[model samples]
Target: MTTPAPQPIDRSGFGTTGKFNVSLSKRYNFDKIFSTAAWVATLFGLVVLAVLLVDILIDGLGRIDWAFLTSFSSRRAAAAGILAPLVGSIWLLVVTALVSFPLGVGAGIYLEEYAKDNWFTRLIEINIANLAAVPSIIYGLLGLQIFVRWLQPITNGRSVLAGALTLSLLILPIIIITTREALRAVPDSLRQAGFALGATRWQVIREHIFPIALPGILTGTILALSRAIGETAPLIVIGAVSYIAFLPELSPKGLQSSFTALPIQIFDWVSRPQTQFHTNAAAGIIILMVVLLIMNASAIYLRNKFQRNRP
Candidate 1:
């Protein structure tokens, strides 16, 4: 078994050095080129987005005012306002959050923490991932059949309640996925420590894991809601009217009232031939953008806050 040890390769042989044979200058040049290209692409995207925001501001700045915020849609473009859709959107958001949060977060915790790793769980995970990518219009049609037709008595036939349920279904996958990811982000040692202290699984999750992951969960929720708020096609399919003359009453009955949303109202205005309507549409678009941006900003702030506060 005693044999001669292998000899070291000759470093001075340039031809035998595969990758090492390449000139350092050539590698450096390639890296520089790729880096420059990346920067250019990034800047180009930023420039386009900035141009869009600036244009929207120019077109919509004058149209937004106290009256625009407080009044209702009218036949006259100048008199039309977003109050109905605004209030409806608020109602829809509240109801959607109420319905989706507990269900989604609970499912996530069950799947990630409690559920056994079996074929059934894997199948559910696969389905949940796929469902998150399903076209929203399909969910809308499903909602129309289930919420609008089947549950007409409860939803009052294409009311805010039905629309909220539809959107709740739409965003449930996102929330669940986000929540699981947030839970997964927590260290397993935290769970072990709780177990060492004689705490139950649920208690560990509720007291330790949830508190650590709260910011991420909340951020995901806000982003999901932002997406729901801006959705028009699903709302259209579920009969969210483009024009509603009156606001929903501030009662449980209001959940069953006919409604519209900001996106639907904007879509309606953009469709009209009148220039004033187009201008008003721009204004509505701005308000919707502001809402979405605010939500996104809040998510960023929460995420940063949690990272800063983490021990």
Candidate 2:
């Protein structure tokens, strides 16, 4: 029998380069083609994001001055300020966090840890998924009917409490989903260790699992609130005024008074005839973007901290 020639070593670590390596195949060019395609797609997405950021900065930068940040809304574009809208948005974020976080996190723990993986839990899970996809406008309608009107006896109509509750409901599903994912990421070995050490179920979740998952829960909460902050329809349906001059205070009476958010204020300005008002609206957009970026960054920092601390 004739002896075959030995193949030279392939530097890229594909063993037996003459036969077993897929990248050396003549018929299939998958690796090169797929890698190139993936890189192109990633570059395209980055380019799009860069273009959007550039456009917004170019249009809005000059319009954002001290006066714009500090003044109240008025008929004249120069006189209008974002103070009240900024304060209102801040209040909304605070109240929404306070109201939503505990309820959402608790429900998530119950579902993920306490409940059995039976038909009822599955049904609840499916409904939550469906709720997440429902149009935000539908949540707006629910806020209008249930929070703004039906719960008038409790909240007395169109209050910040109502708005917060509406936003809470909208974001609750997101929180639950994210929290569950975080909980699931906790290694089963950790739970087993805790139990083997004579820990109860509650103790395992409280001491061993929750600390590991807290960062993810916080990330989800920030993301959900970001969504709520950008929303206009729900606030509009619940009767957010477009021309409020004063900042929102936390008291019940304060909440009953008229208010505005950044988006609504921007909308009101952009709808006007003056060119300067449009510029003001663009400035408002920039402000909203900055706030969102800050919130997201803080959440990311929290996530990193937790990940670092996790054992």
Query: Which is the leading candidate under TM-score?
Result: 1
Clashing pairs counted in every model: 0, 1
lDDT of 1 by residue, 53-125 (tens): 8888888889999999999998899999999988888899899999999999999999999999999999999
* Residue 220 in candidate 1, Cα distance off native in Å: 0.6
Model 2 misplaced regions, further than 4 Å: 1-38
Q: How would you encode candidate 2's per-residue C-alpha lDDT over 1-311 as one tens digit per residue?
A: 99999868767776666655665574357777888999999999999999988887888799888998999989888788999999888878888899889998999999999999899999999999899888777898999899888889877788777887888888989999999998998889989999999999999998989999999899999999999999988888888888877777677576565567898898898889998888888889999999999999999999999889975
Clashing pairs in 2: 71-81
RMSD per model, one decimal = 4.1, 4.5
The candidate 2 region of ten consecutive residues with least summed lDDT is 19-28
The C-alpha lDDT values of all candidates are 0.92, 0.87
